[model samples]
Target: MLDYAKVIVTGSPISKSNFKLFNMHGRAILPYNSGKYHDRYAIYEQEIAFCARLQNPNIVLSQSLIAVLKVFYKSEKRHPDTNNITKSIFDGIEKSGLIVNDAQITRLIIEEFYDSKNPRFELELFGESRYNMKYEICTKKILDEPKEYGPPSNKKNSYLSKKSTFANTKEAAEDSKIHCSICNKVINAENSVTANNGKMRICKDCIKKLF
Candidate 1:
């Protein structure tokens, strides 16, 4: 089973010799056939290509593993080989002792992909207290007008600051008291700074000096 996971990580075309080892498991493992880029390969190249688009390996494996598991689970009732294939996969996962094992991948798959009730944890990495306002502004600018900044002037650290990124966007109006006209920095509920306009919005503290 763990070996099947390797089908995605190898980043190469599948060969007959290596694929033969798993072929004995039969068609239950057929979805993986799509993983192959070569003739007679079962794994779909599109599946792997989608994973490759992600910059993060954990994200890639997490998606691919989940997709493969779902195909097996859904087909189990219709396919006689399904039960045996699923069992073999679990068994292989246990035997391989891979640090990046299937269980963790399974959790990610269920929580992120399979389980509708599961709460998302991706944003949890940034706790509420640490949620970055300034970074959000910078990211928005990059996404909206990405062409403005070419491949980073400094390739090493390409992250742009909000102030620097949105320095030129015109203010909304003089009377708007609440918002930072330049980047929508809001005035606080408690200590609101009145902009040239009288409208209340986000506070200056929300705006960071970084960008």
Candidate 2:
């Protein structure tokens, strides 16, 4: 259950690296003024046309929004990952005041294509309704499966791993489980404290000294 809306807009999609978040003397910062940054700015500027045209004060009307974008490029050349262009799009919508914050977005889908004459992107936004968080499955088993998650970032899952909040980590760990190859036992993925490099797949209990 959601209130959905879609719009056709034109612009070159910018990749994620265009705007990097790095620590400057221990303070995190996002810089601009590169070529990709310029493209990102132009794309944001182009979206103003649609925002003005729609003139809907509440264009984004939910705490969680799932957007599906069909991005069209000029040619079929080497490109970044399909999901790389989404951050700027969400930032632009937020900049236009349509959305309070890009952090409100919980899901995204991006599809790319090549079209010279009509190079544009169609972005569809969906607002999650209340009670959408309560999920259910026919089976009683609660596996360590995430119903919805964003694109992999840094390969570390802060939400469900040991990095999660102390009080909540155990509960999250309860759902994520893996089987130990040597001991033939199932253990919570987080508690296993995996190195995750090669094909090693033994639980912490199985390891002798962790040397």
Candidate 3:
């Protein structure tokens, strides 16, 4: 079964651009994140790590990962750029110990929306094998029965209240199969050659023909 984790960080998102340049003895200059940004990032990273450990205790940090981020902004007029915001979030994920490196993220999906009342970001981490799963299905599964960590809300958010009734069940163990991209056929892992620096696989036969 594919492993996954979900986390929600409640706060105004901070952008990576909030950095200051420091000069040492007029010889070298270094960039440092603003104190406000650093503190915010620490909180976000701690929350993510806590939720990940509780949800997927056996998750392997070395495997490839996929990240789905839903960003909510209090206003659209002067919000930070999406790309800049993601940089801070990704760094938080790496520091959370959920993954050894952010480079393991093979796929990422980001959705932005306006939520003036509750400005927060929801993150879902999944194994690389989950790439083929439908977006709705993956999201619905991950968000089900969420274990919230933020402040208590007297009333649940309308968007979060609509929980899926789908039961979590293990499907056939097909996630282990490695399919060749060239011939579109299943091939043994030992007999297949990785293409595009391990982003894809190709059977020996197909590799011979192409080469």
Candidate 4:
């Protein structure tokens, strides 16, 4: 009955208790709904078009870098503590203008794990290899999948624009008073703000001062 579901793993010996399960990277499937399954392939259709997302790309980038940093941190052993690793990764993310949260990072890691086999891929979050093609595919596949089960609708989801009616929100006015890290200048979210290291409290004009 699960049409879209693929045998992620095949040829594994199944007992009477378990059968027709797809296994990959040590994860097993219990036969979910076909549309609820990994039917993203049917939606995206094209590989290149599917791999693009603000959140997923940033996650892949962060994970890759974290891996490399872990190696060097380990080589030094006790010197670079976990805090140091986080700070270093945070700095790199800041420079690259990626604004993400710790929770988001956690989600990214978990996502990477569920769909992938390489523990190393998710573990090492700070390195060049994080940007590899394989990671890209994984992120794309995960992101493009339908958020809910059953056949996807042709209707588009309604979105509330961030810039829509800032007047309604109480904190909107005070947002302009925040200071920029690069230039130490005040900036507003609406006027010009660039987020790096998951903190958008800085202004783009001020960020330009970094150079």
Candidate 5:
């Protein structure tokens, strides 16, 4: 069973959003990559591919995976939003052929730290095979138990039905008053705007503050 695979790419990390440029041709506008960013990304991809291959030689994972990224920055001045750096790392993992696609990653964890001496990022990929085994074991244990596991009893079902009915009646009674989605404060209908075609109710005070 494969537990996890880790690869570390050593370099000053770059943000995918910061190095884009736009070009105009006639009346159309198009986005292009900066030369410096292109060169740096090429190097990053190569390093990631090399490290991943060394760790998991001749195998590519296709199972549902969890990815953990630990990023170290050179200094506080160079720190950027952690999300901005994920695109490059995910793209690199795809280009490396370590996984069939980055979309296979169902869970992601990210941590940022300052490491002036080693400004780099570490990627850890965890396969779900182990978790699946544990889940199967748990299910078998539950099945072996003496107690019966099935639907609710008639009395319990009646209680749940009554609770649901009460909730609906309460909602109908409060229909005249709108609750602000942000602050969750009850306000009169006139003071609230039905945004997104009544999907969202936001009070005027909140709208002014947010906008």
Candidate 6:
């Protein structure tokens, strides 16, 4: 199973109030009289940049995502309900292109705490599989049978880094240039992603494989 990945957003979380709606005659409607939509839209624009190049290779669109949020307050003694902020959070993530839709998040766990020094919500999106993945465990489940886990190993996966020495196949690496480690094809250095922490370089197409 793949581990849960994290995305850190450094800002005061915008409340769901920004997405609030007014009630008409037995109907609910988004208020168009205010600039809330414009403000929220601007926020979404800035948030998408953070989601760039943040996909995991082993997991993509698992259909099962759990957003674990740690909300920190600046100076408030009593914090607002975490659920109340979920709408804005979901909208931000969807607009950020992290997930196809907010409904894709089948599971959500939100908790609030005080971090007066640094007030922001830390979000971690956990994935399971392509369609029906299971990435979480219920805390209420009985612990009488502790699940067995294997010991950690020091071995690393070098499938991508196996061609790190591609320069030997051609001219000297210094005289030549880097190539896509996965495809073994040459591409621009600026466009490539640092594979295996600089051990290898991959193009945009190959980097998508990581996710």
The candidate that wins on lDDT is: 5
Candidate 2: clashing pairs of residues: 144-175
Q: What does candidate 3's lDDT look like per residue over 44-162, in tens digits?
A: 55665576566556665667877899999998665777888777777776766767788987888899888999998888878876554455634463455644543235445643444
RMSD per model, one decimal = 20.2, 14.5, 22.0, 23.7, 19.7, 25.4
Cα lDDT for residue 141, model 5? Answer: 36
Q: How close is every model to the real structure, measured as TM-score?
A: 0.18, 0.47, 0.51, 0.18, 0.54, 0.46
Clashing pairs for predicted structure model 3, backbone only: none
Best by TM-score: 5
Query: 3 or 5, which is superior by lDDT?
Result: 5
After the best TM-score superposition of candidate 2, give how far the Cα of residue 37 lies from its true spot, in angstroms.
7.7
- Displacement of the residue 65 alpha carbon in candidate 3, Å: 1.7
lDDT of 1 by residue, 119-200 (tens): 1111111112322323122335344533343333455344445454454343434344455544665554575455458553
Model 3 TM-score, 2 decimals: 0.51
TM-score, predicted candidate 6 vs. hidden true structure: 0.46
**Clashes found in each candidate (C-alpha, N, C closer than 3 A):** 27, 1, 0, 15, 0, 3
In candidate 4, what residue range of length 10 has the lowest lDDT sum? 1-10
Better of 1 and 3 by TM-score: 3
lDDT of 6 by residue, 87-155 (tens): 766665665555678786777778777777887777777674532334665676555866453322333
Question: Ten-residue segment with the worst summed lDDT in candidate 1?
Answer: 119-128
Model 3, residue 35: displacement in angstroms?
6.8
Which ranges in model 3 have alpha carbons more than 4 Å from their true place?
Answer: 25-60, 130-211
Winner on lDDT (2 vs 4) = 2
